[model samples]
Target: MGIGQSGSKFAISDLGFVSGGSKRRDLGLNQLILAEIGPIKGDIRRPVSCALIRLLQDPDVAVRLASCRSLCFLIGDCNVSEEDFNEFLPTCWSACFRLMEELQEFDSKVQILNLISVSMEHAGEKIVPFAKHLTDFFQKMWEESTGESLLQIQLLAALRNFVGSLGYQSPICYDMVLPILQKGIDINNPDELNLLEDSVLLWEATLAHAPSLVPQLLDFFPYLVAIMERSFDHLQVAISIIEDYIIFAGAEFLNRHASSLAKLLDGIIGNVSDKGLLSTLPIIDVLVQVLKF
Candidate 1:
């Protein structure tokens, strides 16, 4: 259809022109042009979406990636309401998944990961219907990707948005995440630096947003002591995690980990600078109040 269709005033012919082009470069650039314009027109989203689905699976990586980016732009900019966008979501998700399964490059996976994260974010409550499927997808991806740390990092970033959007429903993804989270937060591992920051943030996000602690999450709590013992850098998140554990895990957690917790606090008390000491006090006070030590 022409840009003049449906009484639309904007001339997007130059932008939409390449949608018909046969070349990879034309296909790739066309997808970007569509992304730059958000939705072409409210009347045409279905046909535009249909074209994007085909382009998203194009042989050229650039074309596929650009199609994913266009979807991201449309979802993020709110040009289409959630209810309206929901119509194309199934095909959009399928095309994205096929690309994810077919693509071998870590960078390409990064783009798709961003695409999923953006979709989950913008789809809002609409995504709840897919919660189980999404949880399963990430679990399977984590298992298959194995040693691909770069992809794992992006996956972790994506999971934060996933969990944040899911709120109380978030812990369902924990079975897949906790093991990875354990490895990511390990101070002993030299390779963890890249994963550490995001892992910690994911951990905090899980603790903050997850409706109830899964068994693995409770088991994951003690790792915080080791983290504090290793460096002061994560102390703020560490403190927040502690408060969460106290609130959620309660006295049972304190009673179980008290000795190591006490030892860790002793070290933090003597070594940290005054400003750091001030920051540390509240956590220590809270601990002391609860444990009476």
Candidate 2:
């Protein structure tokens, strides 16, 4: 067995086709850990995909969750050839459909969170419609203040990220995300504040990846600005997201939403110290560029 960098817990040899081999069955936690550390090299795309597909079907929840997480990460790293991914897509989508159906039955918010995360991260455009349903479920769950459900919050963020990343490539998804966002912004429960905060962060993250969403931004920002004005604790995060919006979405984004964007910036700048204002100089330069153009 090939030893991994840290030690002998797992090795390159462990990732091969025969997952039930002595090492995989004996020492490994699950197919996830095995697929992660195994030495399944470049040409083994189909085999690796098949192995992950099987692992994704494992009866154990933890095993299946781990497999989903690993598969998402692996797809990013493998430099998966297009033809190979085309072959891989059907199987990947099938698992997503199955897992999404399963997630509907999940009582554990954390498991559901991880499921949403990996599904969004790996399933890409294929999972957008389901993500809409999942986000709606989260919206209802957000109302019941069952303590701070961090996983649910983060998964909502991830779902937003996935929708942003996929963009108009999935227009049906576009129609779905905004309504969920509207619901969170309108509802007021002190305990649900963090959920709202996460919702705003999700919106900002979406803006970062999908600049095209800029045109529709005014629909959301006014409510966020009002919330920031009233809340001392969440003000900084709100301002940070606006700054990120300025940077990533660029001047064109600001130009399209100019009047409203400026109003929001004024609100944010008004809350900051002089040092914060000074730090905004570069953003000013960008604004200047947009004006010149």
Candidate 3:
């Protein structure tokens, strides 16, 4: 009933946590602290929140990432019932806006991704104005295509995650995502690593929030099938990504295009080597689940 009792109960669970892994435990505790603190939106804890706010700029990437995640969670919870939404939402908006912009010049996709994820997780509705700018940023970068800039690709991936992770769907995000989906089908140039990843994320976004878009995406279904024919070059990762999208698209999408998916699955099944086949087991399992729906 007390915090001590809660801590003790969690400590016993640590064995299971350790079996699951240490990182999960660390993040779980961090999230717990965040959820407990609520936001400084109503308490007039300006000094304290301001101090915590500075952590967003910490030199250590991990600390900054954690701070971003915490800030987003705090703001998104809307715990500041007594405070004006304008006051608190601005704080969430400013921090996320700066991070998304600064991430363009910096490295570390995971941090950028986390920052965006948390930002959307919280004040997504408030930040709608910036979605078009975010879309422009990604479009220019993808078009540049000078080299396989890992940082840029990862940043795009993070942006895709951020856009989709928003609590509600935004037309701005849908507009941004649709282009990436079309890009993935450009068989002549399919920047499989960059463009395809973005498309898959878009697929997930549509499945979760806008199932109506699946009909439009069916045009690209064959290209998705073609990519699976290789089934080795990041094939496992690719399959895993596609599986989520397929599931998100749901029964209607699957039912309408069952043959297309079955054909793609057929290609994947044929190419699975004894070693490679195991990686695909999850993919196959997910496809079967989608078919059932």
Candidate 2 colliding pairs:
12-39
Model 3 steric clash pairs = none
Worst 10 residues of 1 by lDDT: 9-18
User: Which candidate's TM-score is highest?
Assistant: 1
For model 2, give the 10-residue run with minimal summed lDDT. Answer: 21-30
Instruction: List the RMSD of every prediction in angstroms.
Output: 4.3, 6.1, 11.1
- TM-score per candidate: 0.80, 0.62, 0.52
- Residues 1-293 of candidate 2 have per-residue lDDT tens digits of 22244465644456555666443542253444445555435656655566666766666656566666656555665555555554555555555546655554444445435544554555556554455554555555554424545655665676575666465553445455665566556436543565787776666556555545444554566676567556645655565556655655565557655676677668658877786666556657766765675
Supply the TM-score for candidate 3: 0.52
Q: What's the residue-level lDDT of 235 in candidate 2? A: 56
Ranking by lDDT: 1, 2, 3
Error of 2 at 115 (Å): 5.8
Q: Which ten residues in a row have the lowest lDDT in candidate 3?
A: 12-21
Could you tell me the lDDT of residue 242 within candidate 1? 74
